[model samples]
Target: MMKGLYCLQNAIKWYEDRFCVRFTPTVIYALYPKEEEYGWPQPWPNPDSAGIYIFLDSNKTIVYIGKASQMGARLDHYFGYGENGKCILKDKRVDDISYVQCYSCSQEEPYACLSLEEYLISEMNPKYNKTGRTEW
Candidate 1:
């Protein structure tokens, strides 16, 4: 029994890595949109900016998080075509979307939005964020 259990654990880990399960926290936030009334020019006062996004399941669980230089454009991808020309909306698992806009302090900074996004993901430990081992 011990040997079988060990094998199973290893198999699961292998599958996870193979599927790129160890995703950065920002990836989770990039999949969803923030509540309305946040207003246009998102993360306002800083137009033409970058930020992180999140995708939620029907139960309001965070399934994915991601960072993007152009939050609006990245969001379009989630609502429309996926990498393989597949429609994400057709996927029954995705129920809602939201985002938090994080503007960059300077033009040279990279992944600035991602930093805050990662912190939030680690703290929240949302249900759909399978990449992190923490329990919410």
Candidate 2:
């Protein structure tokens, strides 16, 4: 939703203003669960870019923040079920995630991925992230 993207935009601005560096994400996609599937979105728009992703609850509250070098594969590892129909076990919070916001930057922006992820986790205080959360 826009609220989630708003937080991301704010995070980008905050990081740039504080560090005096540019952090621009090239592709952003908001994915909702499929009615008949139990895996990451099919035909993911970006499979190789390094970036950060946010998990949001049904109410559009951000619950988790994560980063990966391969955004599509990382998401598949979480949402994809095995041939035996078993999900790769992860934080139980995954079940609470109803939507995912993926922000992918160019391969040249790996540092941007890491720093932005940290900054967003700190500012948003997503419940599923264990570190960098600011107490409020």
Candidate 3:
């Protein structure tokens, strides 16, 4: 699992170089919002932060890779509400979600982090990615 994270970070950087989407790899651990922590509509951590996230099966296999400018909002969409986000939610294989923030990417440059997301999808070839694995 730790090795996967390291490769993920490198893939992100490689994607950035290929697409000119520069951003700092300030990896931060993101957690799911717990009902006990902040009540019904729990909101404790910075929801507006941007980052890269992944879903793993119980055996720690990479199931999906995603990214968003607002980490909380993105997580909520999948774990809480959002039709499109249901892709991960509906998948029984996924048991965990983890994230690493694109700490220095500014709001104005959303594309900067997208490259990282793309890299992870391509390199990892996660099951849930719509595009699947690229042949080249």
Candidate 4:
């Protein structure tokens, strides 16, 4: 778990080194139910906001990375949904959830968000991202 979390921390560090912009995650958590004892992101901001999610597995290894138009709703679909849910998290049970609530000053932020997805896919090289999964 520490190793995987370190990788994410390293990813942030690398991003900072290259862009000189320190990244701040809006939420960092283990994948527990919203009503669980551990809890979800407290003081959860903007339930309908655009964001990216970094999903970790039981071993705390990063397994999948994806984006959501609405963070709260989408996460609910996966983590807080049914026993046989059809969402991405159906097959793989995530153990941890880290998020970056995204925004942009430029008009092309959506495109940039896509690029961030690509960049993270490349950098993180998660196992479950079968489509266009890139490696270091």
- TM per candidate: 0.42, 0.69, 0.55, 0.58
Give RMSD to native, each candidate: 13.3, 5.0, 6.8, 5.9
lDDT of 2 by residue, 73-94 (tens): 8977767555555433354435
Tell me how far the alpha carbon of residue 37 in candidate 1 is from the true structure, in angstroms, after superposition: 5.4
Q: Could you give the candidate ranking by lDDT, starting with the highest? A: 2, 3, 4, 1
Clashes in model 2: which pairs?
none
Question: Candidate 1: lDDT of 112?
Answer: 53
* Model 4: worst 10 consecutive residues (lDDT sum): 99-108
Q: Report the alpha-carbon TM-score of model 4 versus the true structure.
A: 0.58
Which parts of model 3 have CA positions greater than 4 angstroms off?
A: 1-3, 17-46, 58-60, 80-104, 132-136
Backbone clashes (count) for model 2: 0
lDDT at position 86, candidate 1: 34
Name every residue pair that clashes in candidate 4: none
Model 3 lDDT per residue over 52-135, tens place: 666554444556777777766776665543454322343335445543233335576776666666757767777667554422
Q: What lDDT is obtained when candidate 4 is compared to the true structure?
A: 0.52
Predicted structure with the largest lDDT when compared to the true one: 2
